[model samples]
Target: MAWLDKLKALFNFELNAPLINITKNSGNSNLGKEYVNSGEKIDILFDNLSKEKQEKLKLILKEKVEEGSKLLEEKSFGLLRELINFQRTKGEDKKVLDFFQNLIPKEDFEALESSLYLRRRFQEKRDVSKLKEDIRTRFGDRGKNISNLCTAGYFENFLMPLFNSSKEGFDNIYNVVVSRSPMAIFVHSAMGEDQITRDIKTGLEVSKKYGIKFLHIHGIGDQNIRTIKRCIYENKELFNYYDKEIFENNGIIIVELIL
Candidate 1:
């Protein structure tokens, strides 16, 4: 009971996990903090749970989220098709087609337009077939990943600091996405059952209470990872990053928690 109370306190009595510094940063930092909370790991950022068990909150199944995503894509394409048709009927004015440029890539918009014009089902592949077919390491160009989700909410909160910038010190990343929308990280890749809290306050409470700066991480595959290697090349301070393995490689599930 005492340990549980301590855990509760570390979890911030009652609330979803806050960014808790490294939890958002996502690396061995949370692992140490989780252990310091000696604590635990679950999901961070996207799904903040664990604190819910006290009064309780049920996590939505990743499958359900996937199903919903599929449905949305379907509906979105259907509407897109009708609008594309409307644009064709209008001829010289391509307002509908022009509008989509803001939402999707030029190639995707062209493909969708072609599919609509041909009265064919536009194939949508979420796996990012274009980026790389079997990349052992993933980047957040599209699909769900922490590297991309780090762009959410307050941009400066984690991004600027991670990039080693207050007023664009390391890179003018702010300008990179000035007009771009934030990428989405799906639920399937978010949390695992064995992990503890992804709640923000809980992670901060653990580190704040325990006081940790230097973090630890396991599993290294490259002599220099693409992201890190780039930083090293420029001799810039490395930006903190997080990853969790959803699968070992056999299945579609593969997300690696860096810590």
Candidate 2:
């Protein structure tokens, strides 16, 4: 019983996982920190459960959390839609839209706007056929993916960092992939599930072996832009195109802690 109690402490059942750290510069960092934290808390809860309850809890926890996450995603998407609509209605000064659009290329901006508007109309009018036709006309085969992006909370926390990063003059990022899902390694490690943790550990190793910076925005939190700024400050080499190099070289020089 003493050994078992000690083992339970390892699970950190009392701990609450960290939330997405939004700041003045980096807005949301949509890293799905909530989702990751939910998983971690469940892991801790699982440790305290009776074996019989643990099995049922797994299914129940996953289901309830997923349902809640779906609703949150919907709400976030609705907020995003409203913001976009407001931007569109504003006459000449599209400063809000311009601020967001500056983070990505013009083509992506156009595609994103078209996709959001089409999906909104479909949701409001409940016309699947019209949506499909618009999809085919505008997006062709990529329509489904586009629709998915529109519905999902893609912009909520993910795109916020770009504003600060761009302002810092580190704007030449070749490609940016914002994962709304947290790394499994982080979840498993938090849960104290050592057996399966090795699998994710290997995956993390693989990413690192390839020198993949794999920017972990959740873990980095509000420090992300500042971290880059510091990297540029400390090393003159990264000053030219730090953002692009950060992505290109897996951020070996700039973001060791985040990776």
Candidate 3:
């Protein structure tokens, strides 16, 4: 208890913090195994530090926070690329292309327009009509199938609102908050695997222990949306993250998208 109290002080955590339980029940147990520790290791490490070391660590953390703020300001064009590519494969209607163009940086939007002109010029020499149609068919079928399951809508309705809203709005929105949705797209080398796993596990455990549900979405594979929907509708409890009441009563679903 004293160690935990020291932990609360060291990490600036509130007293009586809820414990989160993360169980690996998906084919992606590797994803689930990532979330077993809840920063107890950090607490232990901090506990072993001398008073001088603790103060030094605090200064380091403060510095990192300032650095992270700067990094967040760097303009991210990844989403723009994804949207534009999706539109291209799906056969862009002029209205949709215009909408997406409006969302990108002016330079990027211009580049896309130039690329389209080049594509049209090359179209005369190559018989890519079939190839283009194939791409549209494959992606369109996949998109429509996933959309039917309403997993995107589920996240948008239940999970996204939490992130999109202020802290106070999140707290006030639900009487019994069920789960959290974490997209593990950071499996890339940019961030450490261990760190991402630990963060996910800790977040899920804490949320669940406090009666908030945590749902993890693996952002790597072809999302089997229909299967996930069946599992939810049938009350199958296929994964370790399952909360029966939440799935049964509210038609709550979880699906991962490439984007």
lDDT (C-alpha) at residue 12 in model 1: 55
Candidate 1 RMSD to the correct structure: 25.5
Ranking by lDDT: 2, 3, 1
* Model 1 lDDT, residue 134, Cα: 19
Candidate 3 scores a C-alpha RMSD against the true structure in Å of 24.3
Which residue pairs clash within candidate 2?
A: 28-157, 29-157, 30-157, 30-158, 213-250
lDDT of 2 by residue, 1-259 (tens): 3322333353334435432211222124423222223432322333334566556544543564555543234346555666577566744224434555766566555555555655555446554455546554775534443344443323433334544555442233223222212221212113322322343345446545533444321111234444444434554542333243332232222222244
What lDDT does each candidate get? 0.32, 0.40, 0.38
Give the Å error, residue 67, model 3: 41
Q: Over the stretch 172-246, how does candidate 1's per-residue lDDT look in tens digits?
A: 333223222112112222233222122222333333332322221111123213222333234322212433333
Task: Report the alpha-carbon TM-score of model 3 versus the true structure.
Answer: 0.22
lDDT (tens digit, per residue) of candidate 3 on 1-259 = 3444444555464544244222223233334222233443221244445577567655655564555522122123333444466456645434423643544345434433433433443334544344334333544433222222122333235534564555564554222232222332122223344444464565556555544444443222223333344344453334334432222223223333211
Winner by TM-score: 2
Alpha carbon deviation, residue 156, candidate 1 (Å): 5.7
RMSD of each: 25.5, 21.9, 24.3
Candidate 2 vs candidate 3: the TM-score winner is: 2
> Model 2 TM-score?
0.28
User: What is the TM-score of each predicted model, taking all chains together?
Assistant: 0.18, 0.28, 0.22
